[model samples]
Target chain A: MKDIIIRGATIRRELFFFLLSFIIAFGMNLYAIITFKTLWAELLTQLPFLILVTLVIYLIILLARIVFLGINKLLRIKKNKSSV
Target chain B: MNSPYKSRRAFIKKTIIGSTVLMSYPWLEALANESAISMSAANKVRVGIIGTGSRGQGLLYNLLAIETSHNIEIAAICDNYEPNYQKAIELTHGKAKAFYDYRELLDIKDIDAIVIATPLHQHAHIAIDAMNADKQVFCEKSMARTLADTKRMANTHYETGKILQIGHQRLFDKKYLDAIDYVRSGKIGNVTQIRAYWHRNNDWRRPVPEGKPELERKINWRLYKEYSCGLMTELASHQIQVANWVKDAQAVSVIGVGGINYWKDGREVYDNVALIYSYADGTQFIYDSMTSNRFYGLEEQILGDKGTFELEQNKMYSENPPQPAGILQLVNNIEKNIFEKIPIGGATWIPETALEYKGEYITGDFDVNETGISLEVFVDSVRRGKPTPGLFEQGYHASVWTLLGQQAMETQQKIYLPEELKI
Candidate 1:
């Protein structure tokens, strides 16, 4: 079994961390590949769609955050303008 | 031609029974009836309802459809909205007494139970007061808007010992519960993350007959932050609560932003939002909502190392490893056993059977919200004096909703939790 690693670097502080991460990452990747038949499986490694979605969603979510901030600022300015 | 037990019993019981038996041969078969199905315990409860808005009338329709003997009665109905109240009146078939104020209906002696479906701001105040009145209460979701109110609700319910069921109905859905089981059973192999979203178009409007902008906002409390926690509480509460259920832990931190964009109309809350809610175990829940796009709709996709399940209300699709992976197929070249049991007798000739692959299957139930499984459970808990899932403490979860939006609006920075916001 592969040990848990972050960015291909094995965890040194705790051996169990390596084991846990390896199992989880492997299993999730395997499941993701099997379900969606995604590109992650072509490289002999499994991928997790859950993680993919999570990452993608969060990325869009950040964009949404910026968009909201812009709108909030605009509204504040518009309110001040009308009052003046 | 019928036997004496059937023929003589009918004669002895009643001459009308005899007429029925004689008529059952052909023409009068329609007169026969089946016995009602019932699930009753010793203790029974009669219920009253306050605030017959859209949510309340939904509860009313579900209550009327129950043919079981869980000893529940829609003894009273109350609503400030006249049309909604009228609809509830028709739905209950005038079986319950109608009222405008909840206290007046609570005064009725026979109404031993109350279900509050009022706006978010009034949940704690009404529910606590009802509990103090010694009535079992089933309050709708997002119990209150403030931490202090949530604490008071938790206190009152704990003290009164009244059967209180908060209306986070997803807790009662079969798909959600099974999804929890699938993840917890390690089928997904330590589910590290989840994504939940709901998308809609058309600025949440239901024609105001004659009202000021303030009145319209008051009527449609969901569009305003003063009465609602916006989409986080109104819509995302159901999904966010499930994140805890599936991940088996409370969210540790949350960071997000929102703004009113589409159909501004001077609403206080935002039209779109995206949040990354972190859990104590380092897993994260990504939740979002948008008003400009209804194409994506609602979905909750959970991924684990072992498997993945994508859910849309009653429809659920789960993906496990394929059968071919476990099979040798036409060519007997492959033999990979994920979990192979040792031969019992240690004899090859004795024939150890190869692991059978049943393949994968999808499971789904149609018309989930229409099925009323959650409402029936609420009523059963009330009547049997039993506890239900998602108690008033779950309302404290709404505190996170308030905390998330308010902090984001005020600080203009991502929000982090100093304490575990759990009841």
Candidate 2:
């Protein structure tokens, strides 16, 4: 029995990822805005910088995930049986 | 092995560079220095008072005293009610011109700012007009009656780039500032829950002149749904504002129950309201406002895993258990079956103080009154020509949350902050 090799770039998956990222990013931005009481206009002015930072963080997080996954595979540590 | 090491090194370098770049951003520098810009007083800031009711008169008194320290003058006064207008004029010692219409006062060319202490419903319109007239505004809290009105007032403030200070005095209180600092510094740990309540025994009504059933509602506008939200908007706002400040987050949803169980004297608003407002992080602000009981006068308790902050008392209690007194320990042990056969007889058991005193006053002796500090800040901000950052948002959140809580009570369901006003 072979596992199906599914591409990660499917439209549905892409959309889901985009929504998830947006929701997380926007939620954080909203919190900062509420907490600091920064005007929306001021926030929008910093959007470019904020977007860059978000992308950098996302990339770093993705790299860390890949690193952890690789390390897990090397250890041959079975995932908890209950999860499957 | 080399590739992984290189990857790790690259990650660390990127993080350092990213942080440096973020720190060097000019906008952040601007934010830091935003309120530091000061102005030399060319002359006095000519101020106008609108709505000369009890709240209006009280603010007028503060403003009058503030004039001695700050460069401000009461240039004009306005009120719909004749008696109030006359009373405000008397306070000014006939220095300020009286007007029946607020628009007439706004038309005064020399007026630099307007202090609006009108009923909750009238706040938006007066503030908007004043801002349009290039006048700085200090409007009383529960900023406006409706969501749209509150949004409009804030939008107008942003558009005009005018100094718009909502009358939430706690923002300027040294004690509150220090207490909030303590919370933010994680001294009390993450605030998981906040409980606030304001209780009073009176019916919250102002006596009207006889032979005026129509004027009863007008005089006691706080009891009417169209004008005010009774205890929620009137009293709960201050505590709710404090709760938001402690959590550093706005409530995402609110579930409430309220009733006109007592003092039903033809009033439209509820006499009692209990609301649980949940923030995005699942922290809840449990708030209650009642008119029939004065037992628990007022309090805002910020509860965390490490400790609890009682804002009313300005005290903190540690979560760590205290060492039990020897006699109390003996009594407890006997009760728990530790000494089942031992005879334990007592005259009446006196309750011991549960927690030891770890909470200390965050404020110093020279701390100014909250309202006075608020006025000083407002006057200073007006002089500087820069509106204080976060002031509008504080008022906006408190107002929006109060209205949301009211909606929850009226509908008997949980109500969320509207998506449009989420930020």
Candidate 3:
């Protein structure tokens, strides 16, 4: 039950990151379209590009999360050693 | 997305697509064709500049900018004012023959066309004289100071059969053309009302040469009644022309009010004006101009049942904008979590304010130099030995209606366009 709960929390976190990445990517695409003064319908055709940008953002966010966790773990270990 | 459609590639694709779309327009296509035509030295159109004032110098700059591209030459320049004549001569690099009298400039047989940028009162006589001299004429807007003079200018054009193109540069503006096309396509439905205004905060005065107060009236001709109709002819004429173009009809009647409310600088013309022009189809064009507030600098808001076009900003807002479709809609649904449903039962609720729809641009490129393009088109017409169709009529109607609006203000009554003024 503990393992299941952990897995569920991990999935929710990943979903949140992905959603954030998608929003940023979509906003960037919309900005580009409006700036170019082209038809807004072109956003539909730019789906593949939008997805690529979203995935890149998601990867970056995941990498950042890993680095942050490593730093937090190191600090916690240093505290444990000092306490000992 | 990874291999071929990266950001750089996307930019390139958009640029290509945008240019292709622009090229499909008739004016751009014509401009391309015009640029392709090369002329020999002997075939160049020899042109003259009349009234080398501020406006004349502006036209001269545009003319010189396109001299090589359009196969045109500034053969001569004429200005009675000593300072303007000297400045014009300097601008031409002393290549153009300088003349004190415009009649001497007109006498030159080599000059094929002349651009008249004189004061409002001088437009009709100079343009009429240029036409009689067998020279193609390009005169500035507010064709003349009075309705009779405006009619006379049009009559002279009809009588001479010479190419006469007025300086209504918006007729050649790409953004305006595209917006008009959209309006005609019924994208905005029928334009029922147009609210246009030009507001500025300045004295509208030109500095006299130190200790030369006598030159004040001559230098600042726009502020005097004899020389100009002030804000109406100088500023409102341009917006009125746009309103007329959007409606495709001239103002049938106008009622106006004006006063020299703010400046109190002893200028004969009004410093502020507000007018309502009624079109034949009952379309109302409300126009106002002032020199006291600079907030809403200038705009012609063409409103219709379906949408509104803020022309100066080159933006269009729709009453009923389309919902996001395909990928956008999918993303929006996922973000909003489509599975969630909220119950709503309330008293009557309605939006009682303007919709916050961010409008879209009317055209891809908005950096068009309309004045330069207008001059280039005039040169092209001169080369072809024919006038641009509908240009003269547009200028004529705009000038006539604008003066009538001024008349309405002075008479304190609704003024109608006289039948004789209709060409």
What value does the lDDT take at residue B423 in candidate 1?
Answer: 53
Query: What does candidate 2's lDDT look like per residue over B1-423, in tens digits?
Result: 132222332332333243433223222222223342223366578889999999899988877865744557888999988789889989999999999999999998878889998888999999999999999999899799988888898889889999778888776454565566667667789889999999999988888888877788779999998999888889999988988978778888999999999997889999999999999999999999898999999998989888887777767677874443332333345467854554477645556756545666554432345565566567766776778777778888998998888889999998988878754
Off by over 4 Å in 2: A1-84, B1-41, B321-359, B364-367
Fnat scores for every prediction: 0.00, 0.00, 0.00
Reference-based lDDT, residue B346, model 1: 62
User: Between the candidate structures 1 and 3, which one is better when assessed by DockQ?
Assistant: 3
lDDT winner between candidates 1 and 2: 2
Q: What's the lDDT for all of these models?
A: 0.63, 0.76, 0.84
Which scores better on TM-score, 1 or 2? 2
What is candidate 2's CA lDDT for residue B87?
A: 96
Q: What range of 10 consecutive residues in model 3 chain B has the weakest lDDT sum?
A: B1-10
Ranking by TM-score: 3, 2, 1
Query: For each candidate, C-alpha RMSD in Å?
Result: 25.4, 25.2, 9.7
Model 3 spans with C-alpha error above 4 angstroms = A1-84, B1-38, B324-351
Each model's TM-score? 0.64, 0.70, 0.76
lDDT of 1 by residue, B1-423 (tens): 232223222222232233432223221121122122243544445778898888887777666655233446787888877887788788878878998887888788767788888888888888888888878887887767765676778778778888666777665444564555556556667677799899998788666767454558658888777788777677887777777667655676777877777877877877888888887778878888988899999988786666566655433333454534211121123123434566677665855673343423223432245225545555555654645444444445645554564465556676665454445
Cα deviation of B32, candidate 3, in Å: 7.3
Number of the top TM-score candidate = 3
